[model samples]
Target: MKNCIIIGVAGGSGSGKTTVAKNLVKAFKSEDAVLVAQDAYYKELKEMSVQERAGVNFDHPNSIEFELLKKDLETLLKNQIIERPIYDFKTHSRKEETITIHPSKIIIVEGILLFAVPEIRDIFDVKIFVDTDADEMLLRRIERDIHERGRTFESVRDQYLKTVKPMYLEFCEPSKRYADIIIPRGGENKIAVNMVIAKLKRYLQKGAL
Candidate 1:
């Protein structure tokens, strides 16, 4: 790729950023687009006990290794492959094995904190934010945690009240001002998704010419 474009997608947890990112990737050829998640670079909690790790505030920016994410993005942008870390949600730590991501023409990086952190945020060529209602976000989060993270309703609710909502208000919501595009109603908004895909295709076409 002569000109690789890095697109950053940000939104609160359960706000449909992941869905939007996935749909965006699906709109293009697999080789031309790839989606990377910021959660993959979560800070290693090996020193803490599993129980203790469960109590860690994952929604906070401190809990993520943005420097590593930045480095990996740089590597991919340089037309190099990266050994992307595999995070074990059950263990709340990184697994030994890493996934390999080859260079691609379009990179979509989705995370809650990307827009909140200047070091990582400033690197993106295009920034997107997905806006979803708080009630809807909480509901989606509850369902996701129960199914994916092996959490109970009580624990998920407690964590949402303790960290997720508060952190999102402080960090994620405020960062929306930085976004070049804001997709409301998330991936369910087909028109919004189509528009974004169209814009990206146009950009790539311009680069090819």
Candidate 2:
């Protein structure tokens, strides 16, 4: 089996990182290419009330269970299957059922802080940073959180002001230095994604697909 090509996409919230990763997956010839979001590994908040959990600084790098994510990737790299956690954003808890992840030739890990943790960074063969303007990011985040993630406008603003912005500056932005590629404008920039596809294709030919 070819070695699993782990690609990490890190960026500010609503920077269109996931969109780019998904498009890149579509560009791949093999159906084994899969994109996994870091949001899926948010630490289970079963003990806390929904309101209290909402107050949690989810934007913090510490909020994710990176160890388990790393282990899942490690297993996948060895051609093994693993169960991924299912998180409920509305209730702020984890569901009993898990999403089964089978081995893939390419794994795209898109998240806010994938490169913030040294251990996780080392696991990725390629690291990408999606760059976008802060104001636009906030606007997109507000819309998405309210309509898709069951978040209130006030709460979203509060979190962005208190945690998201600061955490992004302190953690996410700084981690850009670790990226092998920095993509501006995220998904809309087909050139960047095409470059990524080309590299992956070359790597695959070199027996490291």
Candidate 3:
């Protein structure tokens, strides 16, 4: 992992941050890059009841286990292996099992509030923010929650209104000022994605020098 590059992809939930991260990973190939999702680092709620956990404000920065994430990233940067946590969205807690993630030349960190914290933001060589319209993001969130996260439409809408939108405005949106690049229209912007890939290639090549 000599000259390993860490890229941070930050955006509102359903704003296509994951899509951008996935595209970058595909471009780099699995052997050369690793994707670490911030969502996986959500704080375990073992002490809370299911009802209480359901009411928790997941969008807040305090809800993530960022210390663990930072340690894992540091380990990866040192060319070592780390065990990443497994999160269960349905249960609102972590699973006992962990996934073994090996160090790679490129590490893509994808999360909604990554750039909001200075400790996390400072580690990234490239910080990207995906900018999609708020209305569109809400629609995508509703769809994803219903189909993938086992959430009911009413619940999704309620959570979005109660926590998600406010948290995004207070934390996620303000972090955009820290971004090195902002991609509009999220994953649909192929040009922006390609540019990012090219920039990464340049960094890799320069490191070789």
Candidate 4:
């Protein structure tokens, strides 16, 4: 099997990192690329009450099961299939089901805190940081959490003020310095996204992976 290319997409919540990741997958075709979300590896909170889990600072690096994520990524890089976990944001816990992920030519790992951890940062062949204004991100986040994550507007706003913004400022923003590419305006910046795609295609052509 040919070597796989691992791309890390990091940004604050609602920064459109997912858009960049999706565009990359679309660029390569889903058959050639697989997307892995770090949110799925949120440390299982089975031990905590729902209320307690809700209060947990998910934006922190300590909240992610990086060891498991590292193991799965290593397995994928070795051209092996692995069972990826599914996390339920509404319940703030893991689901029993897992999705099987096969090795692909490209793997896009997208997360808010991927770069906050050194071990996770070292595994990426390309590191991308999606930058967006905090106000814009907060708006997007509020909408997403309320509509999709079953969160109320008040709760989302409270969480943002209590933990999200603080964590982003402390961890996510600082991690931007490590990015090989910084995408402003998130995934909507077609020029930046295309540039990344072109670079990856060239690397594949050169068998760099």
Question: What are the models' TM-scores?
Answer: 0.97, 0.95, 0.97, 0.96
lDDT of 1: 0.93
**Model 3 misplacement above 4 A:** none
> What lDDT tens digits, residue by residue, belong to model 4 across residues 139-181?
9999899999989999999999999999999999999999999
Clashing residue pairs in candidate 2 are none
TM-score of 3: 0.97
Candidate 2 Cα outliers beyond 4 Å, as residue runs: none
Which residue pairs show collisions in model 3? none
Q: Once model 1 is optimally superposed onto the true structure by TM-score, how far is the C-alpha of residue 57 displaced, in angstroms?
A: 0.8
lDDT of 1 by residue, 4-78 (tens): 899999999998999999999998998999999999999998789999999999999999999999999999989
Candidate 3 contains a number of clashing pairs equal to: 0
Candidate 3, residues 14-91: lDDT per residue as tens digits? 899999999998987677889999999999899999889999999999999999999999999989999999999999
Give the Å shift of residue 51 in candidate 2.
0.9
Those runs of model 1 whose alpha carbons end farther than 4 Å from true positions after fitting are none
Q: What is the lDDT of residue 166 in candidate 1?
A: 95
